[model samples]
Target: MSCEKVLALLNDWLDDELDASQRGQVRGHLDNCVSCAQSERSLRNVKLLVQAKADRGEPSDGLRNRVVDRLTHERAQGPTSLRWTRSPWLRAAAVLLVLASGFVIYSVVISGKLPSIAHATVAEESLARHIGTGVEGPVEPRWPFETIEDAQRVLERELGTATKLPIRSEQLKFKGASPTTYGSARGVRLFCEYKGRPFSIFALESIPDEVRQRSQCCFCRRKDDRYLVACWAARDLYFSMVGTDLTEGEFMAQLMAR
Candidate 1:
């Protein structure tokens, strides 16, 4: 496919809305074409950014009160007294201000809701996320699956491309996997149970800088209560291994060897 065709198909291509043949053509073009590949990555990042914005939490009490106060003041002034409404520039600026306020409110709420993630500590976030995520009902989201291979195929469509999965091995005994986010990039989260203990592996696009060992091959561990979160970076991906009842460095030792 030519650059123009690939660029036109980029949205559907990243959204995985294209058919098999079209997807192959786009993928092939991206592999050989540097500009197109960068464009594809940029589009993917933009999608993730939009998804992050869409998942914003509700407005906080203080921000909500302030917004209400502003609206009340404007209402008390009446339309005729609000002279800014007469100028297009001022009207646009007013709209932008309200939108900016909404953005701040959403940011505050999300940070309050997921404090660990807001802090961006890989091990800490891993521990928090491990405690939070798992299958909730008889049937889970994205159609659910029992293996990473099945999950990879399913999530490739969700993420809109061919992809690879993390933390795959016979020893882990995959129980389930789902689509997740790693900062501003796409991620995959998988669950496993071995020897009757629960574990979670979060696969990320890049290794976050918060890890203490991030300076050297990017590996670190955080132990909280019964959970042990070991984060590391390897070729083309980053992973966080969260499990319970493991020693301080047990998971790290094993993961480092691999």
Candidate 2:
């Protein structure tokens, strides 16, 4: 895909509306293009800021009180000081700063980074690993592993619970499994092939509750049209599934259906 096409699809990509194949094209393009990469970074930063602002939900009483108190104090100051601080332009600037500070605090407290970026970072990593593996190679899982059972044992040793493999259908073929690290957390990834398409499922213990709570069912994002990321929290584990052929809703239904 050209830079223009990638740029045009960025917003849909961020919102998880794009299909998996398109996502892969964007990811592939961004890999070798420095200019597009920079544009992507800038666009992502703006998205993170916007998501942080919305995730804040509502103003906190303490933050509101502080802003109000500052305004009231400035109002009560003598005329000389008022002349310095009471200009309309200065008040607008002050309000903007306060709001900006509130978002900064929200980012720090909620996820220690912008929640969207942090989650997207992990998703991007998953997509990279999956894409790099390609579609037709012999499934070789790392860490001396061969089976999902082995992966479960290793994951249990690290995370204290066996991975809950979500596929129940007889047609889903297990390809391989491996352990992985996302941010500061350790987890396991299971690879499978269904209907000739390969995908990966990841389980991590590091996602913040704030980030997990953003979606009740699944939080999906697109790295490229062919790459889809679907994430959710369960018990003490945060789970993500990345696939080139899967839709967020389909992945969720497969994993979550009883």
Number of the top-ranking candidate, with TM-score as the measure: 2
lDDT per residue for candidate 1 within 1-258, as digits (tens), equals 899999999999988899999999999999999999999899999999898887777777699778875565444334633433332222322332333334345655876632122213344555355435532333232311334576544433322222122333333455776666554444556666644557655655433444424321212234354555544343224455566565433443343333
Global lDDT of model 2 = 0.51
State each model's CA lDDT, in order. 0.51, 0.51
Per-residue lDDT of candidate 2, residues 1-258 (tens digit):
998998898787777887889888888988988998888888889998887777656777699878865565444332632432423212322332333334445646886764232322233444345434433324344422345676544433322222233222344456666666555555556776654567666644345434443432232345544455544443334555566576543433343332
User: What's the TM for model 1?
Assistant: 0.31
Q: How close is candidate 2 to the true structure, as a TM-score?
A: 0.33
RMSD of each: 30.9, 31.3
Q: Which stretches of candidate 2 lie over 4 Å from their true place?
A: 1-147, 150-168, 208-213, 245-258
Please list the residue runs of candidate 1 whose C-alpha ends up more than 4 Å from where it truly belongs after superposition.
Answer: 1-147, 150-171, 208-213, 216-223, 234-236, 245-258
TM-score of each: 0.31, 0.33
